[model samples]
Target: MKIMEYMKERFQNLEFIPSIYNQWGIGIHFCLGENIYQLKEKEELNLKRFQVVYEQITIIFNELFEQNDDIFLVTNMYKHKKEKCIRKLKVYQPFLKCKNQKCKNHLNQILVKTYPYPFEINKAEEYEMQQFSLLCKPRDLRVTELLKAASNEDFPLKPKFGGYSTDYPDVFFVNITKDNIFFIYDDRGCEVIALDFKRIRHLYEKYHDWVEEYKCM
Candidate 1:
């Protein structure tokens, strides 16, 4: 088969793998390319027999893992927004106009909520030390459309940062790894949800190790 055909089949097969969260179905991320490359470089050729198939398949695998990981900030944004709706708070949006004057479009910061962090933070103040802006995830319909668009590709939805848009309200994901805390804010800069990173490296590794077992299946 052609390279394109091979990649299509590979990703389709990936859909069968269940999410680590709860046997929920989900695809891997697309940002793990560098990780895979590093893993390959670290391999000891003398101890292991490297094959063309393994190399080719892992290139895609690492990308999927990393692509799914964004700083914990996305989850924070969702929480903050939800709180405002509940209390009837006015959502604040920063005035970041679209650079295109004739385009009849403008942009602002938005935060989206996500799951707890994979690690912890010891220094809580680090999160407050700096402000950050994040890319907003596409809405449901937009996400669906994107999936459909990617379905035809060799590496469909090779997940990377999507471009800026007006819909996303700015937010922050705070105290990752440095100290085990997650702070989520809404479009209006209000604290919405705060949580601790439940997954320690040991725990996450235990779960991730299952992927090795998954490969056998």
Candidate 2:
């Protein structure tokens, strides 16, 4: 059976119903109803909820393993001690192809599944990237740059963080480089090519002032 089908079946069997169902129907969400229950009551309820979620996750892992033992090797479930709930579930194997094929040859990649009990469910792509970074080591300088750029939205020349230029209309070209260096060019013709990640990150933090100045100009 497919992963989604397995998950759906397992979730359906659970006694507690999911508060929200994802639009794709593949993802399930359960809220702790923090407002309705007291802290101690919530903790007790969450522990029971975690047990159910963990069982469902284990079922999924077993299904994945049955499909391809080599593809899915490690399965781990983590819970928040204070809240007494499962926060994340990770399933991974060595040298797996990324779903996006961005890192086809990279080793030790992981897939993270999070519960809505602890984390807010939004931006699925961003969460996937975050999980990928946590599980896999950087294979090369280019991979390193891409991961860093994705995580740090405030990076130089990032359009999302208000880094833009009329000179370079295509923001992607300006932010990403063939040489794995970030090139930042302001409207004043001043340029900064950062080879080191730390240096570039520091510059990213400091660039807000420059952005303010540029806006005034």
Candidate 3:
């Protein structure tokens, strides 16, 4: 089922959204640094703890996302927008498109899906969107630039990557810039959905408290 809502019914016509949870599927939720970010009421303390763990999670995500792997970006809207809260995306038109036919052909070359973020819930639907997926090599997406630029109040600006086994062949949905969590599920389905997670396991083995696991929603 869909974790988020579509801004328009027409978007339903595209390929399936990656966030669509798989039926009868097992998964894992890597908690944000032992949930320490929630324990701290003092903003400074939380930020300090968050920085350390965030870097660690970013490392884990990077390890999972190989440098040469084909990646899918849920695009169509602006790269960044005003987010009052997590998942609640309020946006303007992002002027990111292939400037030339070569680039356009390189992008969205195959596999496209349209999905919504949390903003479509309640009254935020006023910001009608036309979000769809795009596919390209990792370098084509400009991973470092996208990550560096989106460290602030934008949905995609602070994105994260997630691997979901949504019915067979498996899928990797990299929410380029959103939350602080680096989520992946290998509880079942294909053991080789993507990377082998050698480093993530090393982190868990040596630093169990640094990571948290939960059944995906």
Candidate 4:
């Protein structure tokens, strides 16, 4: 699939894989590519990054699983947003978004509500982390559309600072046993990390010249 065509100005790759464990990864910033089409300078590169990472993740998932295999999706749920609509007289999105009627039927129709987090001043709003996930085949949801649109809508803030560590506003986590792939879209650029060489070297080599240095992330 062809994304926008652009020239590389100062493309630098970030490689940091834990040696103590398995899961080595390499990533690049979106800004490195000069004159990218349809991307605003100040805005986060959501679709562009998703497009690349989705292809990689699906390929990796396919490598490990089978044509009929069901991969797991652990998408983060917005606690703040959930609070806003929790008390209203309507079904919460997690329930509504479910495709299985049987599953939806079992779920209680509860309105969304918001209760402030009670804790220290440092952690005034950093601990409300919840996720809605599914275990199904890749084709079921056409996950690209669901993720490209819903994830951002669900969790709008792409955490630049510290909030909920688990809740990466614009990041997507792909886990396979101990090995994992992190789709980090909020950072410098669209980066995909393959842990412990779980099949990421090729990705890294694909952009070898652009890779900069290895840091301790």
Q: Give the TM-score comparing model 1 with the true structure, all chains together.
A: 0.21
Worst 10 residues of 4 by lDDT: 1-10
Candidate 3 collision pairs: 78-94, 150-157, 156-177, 158-177, 158-178, 159-176, 159-177, 159-178
Stretches off by above 4 angstroms in model 2 are: 1-45, 67-217
Candidate 3 lDDT over 1-217, as tens digits, reads: 1212321221232233233322212223334434444235553344554354446545555755665554454433312234322121211112223457756464434333333433435544433334444544455554543432232211222333222112111223442222111222322111111122432355445544544442322
Residue 215 in model 3: shift from native, Å? Answer: 4.5
1-217 per-residue lDDT for model 2 (tens digits)? 3223333443333211111111122221212112232224534433333333233333322222222122211122323323332222212222233544554433423334443222355432232111112322223223322322222332233212211121111111111111111111211112222223343333334333332111100
lDDT tens digits, residue span 1-217, model 4: 0000100111113212112112332333222222233344786554564455345444433443443443334333334433432221111233233566744542333212233443245555744534323444444434444334422333343312222333333324343433334443421333444434534555455655434343224
lDDT of 2: 0.25
Per-residue lDDT of model 1, residues 189-216, tens digit only = 1111112223223322433522322111
TM-score of 2: 0.20
Q: How large is the C-alpha RMSD of every model relative to the true structure?
A: 17.9, 23.6, 11.1, 12.1
For each of the candidates, give the backbone clash count. 29, 0, 8, 15
Whichever of 2 and 3 has more lDDT, that candidate is 3
What do the candidate models score in CA lDDT, each in turn?
0.24, 0.25, 0.35, 0.35
Distance from true position, residue 99, model 1, in Å?
Answer: 5.0
Deviation (Å) of 127 in candidate 2: 12
By lDDT, rank the candidates, best first. Answer: 4, 3, 2, 1
Candidate 3 C-alpha RMSD relative to the actual structure: 11.1
